[model samples]
Target: MNTFITLAIVLIALSFVYTWGAAASRRVASQTGEKLHSRPPYYGLYLVLWCAIPAAIIFIVYSLITPTIETVIIQSYFPQEVLNDAAELANQTRQVESIAGGFGMFGEPAPYQVQAAAALKNVEWIGKMALVALIAVAAVAGTLVARTRISPEFRARNRIETAIEMLLITCSAIAVLTTVGIVLSVLGEAVRFFTFVNPIDFFLGTSWNPRFSTTGHGGQGDFGLLPLLWGTLMITIIAMIVAVPIGLMAAVYLSEYAGPKFRFVAKPMLEVLAGIPTIVYGIFAAFTVGPFLSTMGDAVGLDINATSAFTAGIVMGIMIIPFVSSLSDDIISQVPQSLRDGSYGLGATRSETIRRVILPAALPGIVGAFLLAVSRAIGETMIVVLAAGNSPVLTANPFEAVSTVTVTIVNQLTGDTDFASPQSLVAFALGLTLFVITLCLNVVAIYIVRKYREQYE
Candidate 1:
């Protein structure tokens, strides 16, 4: 059956099971005239959890193993020579899978390949059927086990709560482990890259033209970091220049000055800019803002490229405006009213009160918000990719076309390059560097924000 169809069936079955469980629980409670540990709905929820969890686990396990089974069965039909060569084996296996799925075969498939494809289809169908059966079996077993215990004496509420707690803990552990896995994977790839390119050269060098590098002096490529690093910082600084004042002023106006009606309407309208996809922003920058700037620059007797650090930065700054405005508004609003009241009692004007009391109180959080915006700017990819003309040259001019770490990472990882080569692996190094930079910035921002909270709260 189709995945969606199966899911729908499962959902319908679960709903029926829930109704059955609740009705049965209500009958048990009423017939025996005993106070239930929980209401009928809680017992239903407990049964639903028991049925779903085991079924989900069985489905997941079956899905994971199906591919391996297909591979083995397909390999059994292929010649030893094809199986001996890893590339040939992979290619043939892909062809088999494609033909089995009724696509990707340009012409008639070979006899053995067709046979293998047929077998693969059989195996996949068997796997799917087995998975469906296993899920049903597991769900029924779990339901029966739970059903026997579902009496007025059973603490279904306590059991359901405990299950929910475990689920939450599992989710937390999965998130932590995922982060750890990413760090380890990037570090491992970076180590592989470092073996080919000198760590010092990769980190400190000024050039960044990456191609195939021989294992010779400095790994034979200008895999420098400075040029890309400079581009990233330049664009980020320009973004901050554009974003900070405007976003903060917007926040201040909304929180401290604007009428409630205007604030309600205007704030979301401003934030709508943030909700626009970065790719769309990039396209706008490239096609609209970039040309607009270039025309304006030419009118003013300046030579500005359509795609430059300035263009990308301007668009990125616009994109991150809500990050600053929304966050600053929250922080600013959180400042205790007593501080404003005290400032007013001391014969302070609104502006003076804001400058001396409210701002100082909320400074750390505002700083944190700025840093958050900075982090967002540094990590942004599409705006730089499409707007910032891909020139990996170190320069101080805002008008110059420049490439950033994120764009470089995308360029390096694209195409059929060998992952073991420094050319491809450099992407990981660039990614790791960004991760570290953002991580450090986040850590510092969090520390500052927390300290401010301690004083304020």
Candidate 2:
């Protein structure tokens, strides 16, 4: 609440500074009887940037460091035993912060905890005041310095544009750094997992019975990836079999044949599938689709499980249709009208033009979209979890239940388990594998998109 109030104060200060700077600039221009380099609003925005940017940096830096500082300070009051254990120290710090903020603990805290909480409250109060003072100084100094610089020759527009460009670059850098962090963190944990289990056995061994598995030195139980990997592939292939052709045809019809009114009505309705929760899809598959498929199989003298990969895949494909259709429609629509006109002038029919000209032109983007949808399919958890039936058997029969890498990852990590055990560590290994696969898919998709985009350009 204090931080929010501080933010409000900073915003109000910035607004005042902007109004003052804009009026001051206009006054100077009128007095000098010279043309202003940029509009008054540009000057106002320029001053707002100056007043807000430094103060934001200070506030952010203080906000990030203050908790760690408080934790360390409070730990000085912790009992020696608590201080000795990293986890205990962390728990104590959380308790102190909670108690200091008047949230009240379940029981009366120790004398040392009371002392620590009091000290923490004071430290937080001091930190907030210091933050406000720093922000005031930065804002006032920026307003004074920037307001003085607002003259007829000041290039406020150019400066503001450059500032916007820098902001965009900073956002891009943060995205890249986040990806790097994820890869490194997953890779580190996976390396630890490898120390406990053989990579070859984990990848090639057929069985996936990780329960009651012996840890350390030589792994005892089967920790195989083949069953999960095969199940994942089966579901993905089945989904693509359903999604690709249907989605592509839908895109073609919508882009080429549908009237404007129909297209307008249909597109959002189709995209609505994208917004429906996967959990709801899981329920739909489990209760409705699964039994329906099993009965259909029974009518045809074929065995089928109520919750199998086939059931999950059909629903998963339906879920991803929007991804393929929406992107393919946009890509096909982007094909130059001149090309279509030329095809028509050459006496080709609509279907021929669509097949020979438009599809070929949009192939790269369509392929990219397909790969992205495949990635989406591979990453799906809830639908697969509920519909794929928790079976880790290595089997080729779609009628039988089988598990997936994602399902296994969820199972391995769920509930209270010792992280030191190989069972838990295997989750990290599975995660890294999934990450690598999806990353490769994304990279290929990006390459295809960029390569053809540049060629078209």
Candidate 3:
């Protein structure tokens, strides 16, 4: 189903792009008083863009919203009497859904099981076929309307520009919508968590445990924010410690020092690091780095867990080196050649010029690169999942096993507990916290880049 929808969207986008290019070419030729070098197909492409881009956007919005709307409608048909009875409602809804799946036409099942099953199949077939027919009709209408606007006097250039503008607007809106949706979803879950666990305990407690008992007399779990925060910061700091120097030096070499032949080979090699699966990195951290650290710890007479934050963090840093170097190298290379020339003319050494002039000019972009790498490091999961300890102890020691919020989220949701349980809902609270922190970091990075731009400009 998703594949089909995606193919339709792709086809729509291609048609729009084609229509815009064709129309644009024709308009350009007319304005310049020259015969069009390109044929009518280009104009057709321009028209397709005008038709498909808006329609495709509408379709995407509909697709996302349609499921929720349908679910609400289906759920609404149940009586308030049933919905109000918590235990009864759960059972009734489950049974109704099962009956609907196996024996109903819409919400009504036949008296006999065989007749009911046949009715259910008939309902499904009719519904799906109707939907497909509607989509086909919509597509045909959209294409025809777009093609109609493609006559010689249609101002194809302006129409294409309008379509492009709409597309850009839609793309920007999608980014905002995605963020909003994630936050809202997480916020709803967090609210449920706050009901079972005290807000103060979750925020202020030192210990980070969250076990709740149904008997109402068992010790309520500690819900401290500090320990998890500490573990996350520690691992992030370790990762930065490893990644920053190596990535920066690699960037320096690639942008300022490497020969053309060496660069051609080396740049792609660095990018290869980015291509490696995080799971592979996780296994490396667990099996390779963990054992190496244990051996070193044993020789030094220091205890180290087989799965520690240090091993996970260092391995994660290695995973993010390409992000830092590639971005930094690009920014460094963009430092105006004149700045380097001026430094060299003053009899400064190559290193002096790079360190004083080029680096300073490129500082904003470099900072942005680092921040992006840091964000990647902080949100990283698999390496930590494989190597970082599951205990949420608040410890500064890198060799000790520690858990992150992401690890806890995975552990909680994968268990047998009901989704409404505080144990399960706490995942959302943690997710919300992570989202806010990352969002703030990104804002700061953007500000730094902007300020740097102003300084240089």
Candidate 4:
């Protein structure tokens, strides 16, 4: 039986047993003319917790340790030659396990490998049987102990609530730990990259050309960051120019002016823009907007590449419109109606009231929405990748082709290059830099929003 199915069966059986225990205790209490401290359900829950929690802990610990133990047992069967290096041993062990699981071998298996595979299969079966047996024993012991302890005076509800609170804290801690782990991994790799390429050159140099090493040579190209940063900012500026005004105005109209019937129909339709895949936007930019801009620029006697920052910016802006509008609209709608009433009582017109009263009251949220849109624009990859011609240049022209940090990261990491090489390691540095930039932007946005919120509140 599958481990999950076995676990489910154990839990279900224990639930029934606990229910019976609760019912028997309640009947005993009634016959003895004694009152229970907590409800009958609390007693059932207490018994269920005792049965399930210990078994779950055992299952989790066994699952975590099983692979390491199996790997050690398999490695013990290998010859001294195969076990000379840890990396090679691990690779060979994976191959044995894959073949044992019927996933097919990478190449023809040796006699020793075939033996190891059989051993692995047998060990896995034994492990599963041992795990099931242990869980059964734990469940039976817990049920007995819980039944013995269940009396009219037991504080079952408090113990159950404490367990639940601890579970919630554990889940929250896992999320925080996972985020820290990712950031630390990226930061460590980036530090290794900086040892090869100077931090000053990476940050301040205007050039960016990462030539891969060939013929046992090292990397021989500029690893400047300014070009990518400039391109990113230029495209983001253009996108915000297109997105912010239109999105905010739309939000204002929808929230303050539109009738209920119109809002109900139109809001969903507008938000559908957010649902469209960004790759589709990239395709549209590459095919339609890019060519149109080039032709229009030629007609006007200006130089514009077919695939340029202008094309990507406009498309990305369209993609971000729903983000700004939806958030801003919600914020605008949340403004207290009493504020609007106060403005109206002062004989202020609708437009004046909206411009002066409603906008100021909702400014903090609107700023947060705009900053979020800007972050989204900065982090966008697909639209820029397809539409921007991807020239790593430090020019300020939107009509020129450019590349972003994300695009460069993709370029570096896509091919089969050595992770130890500067060519590939640069991707981690670029990712870290982008992360820091976004983090700073978020901090600034939060600070500004808080300042305004304090004033308004």
lDDT score of model 3?
A: 0.78
Candidate 4 global Cα RMSD? 2.9
TM-score per candidate, chains pooled: 0.91, 0.92, 0.78, 0.91
- The whole-model lDDT of each prediction reads 0.90, 0.89, 0.78, 0.90
For candidate 4, which ten residues in a row score worst on lDDT?
Answer: 212-221
Q: Looking at candidate 1, what is the lDDT of residue 154?
A: 93
The residue-by-residue lDDT of candidate 4 on 236-348, one tens digit each, is: 99999999999999999999999999999999999999999999999999999999999999999999898999999999999999999999999999999999999999999
Alpha-carbon deviation at 103 in model 4, angstroms? 2.3
**Model 2: residues >4 Å from true position, as ranges?**
2-9, 76-88, 214-220, 443-457
* C-alpha RMSD by candidate, in order: 2.5, 2.6, 5.8, 2.9
lDDT of 1 by residue, 1-457 (tens): 5789977998999998898789889999889999888999888888898899999898788778878888999989999899899999999899999999988577777799999998988888877788778888999999888888989889988988999899899999999999999999999999998888888988889988786467445555789899999999999999999999999988988999999899989989998988899999999999999999999999999989999999999999999999999999998999899999999999999999988888889988898889989989999999999899999999999998999999999999898888877889999999999999998898888888787767756
Measured with C-alpha atoms, the lDDT of residue 384 in candidate 1 is 95
Instruction: Write one digit per residue (lDDT tens) for candidate 2, span 1-457.
Output: 5779967976787788789878988998999999999989889999999888888889899989997899888998988999889897888788888899999787889899999999998998899889888988987787778888999999998999999999999999999999999889888888888887889988887888887736633544679899999999889988898999999999999999999999999999999999999999999999999999999999999998999999999999999999999999999999999989999999999999999889988989899889978998998999889898979988889878889999998998999988878888898899998988887888888887787767556
Residue 275 displacement (Å), model 2: 0.2
Give the total clashing residue pairs for model 3: 10
Quick one: ranking by lDDT, best first? 1, 4, 2, 3
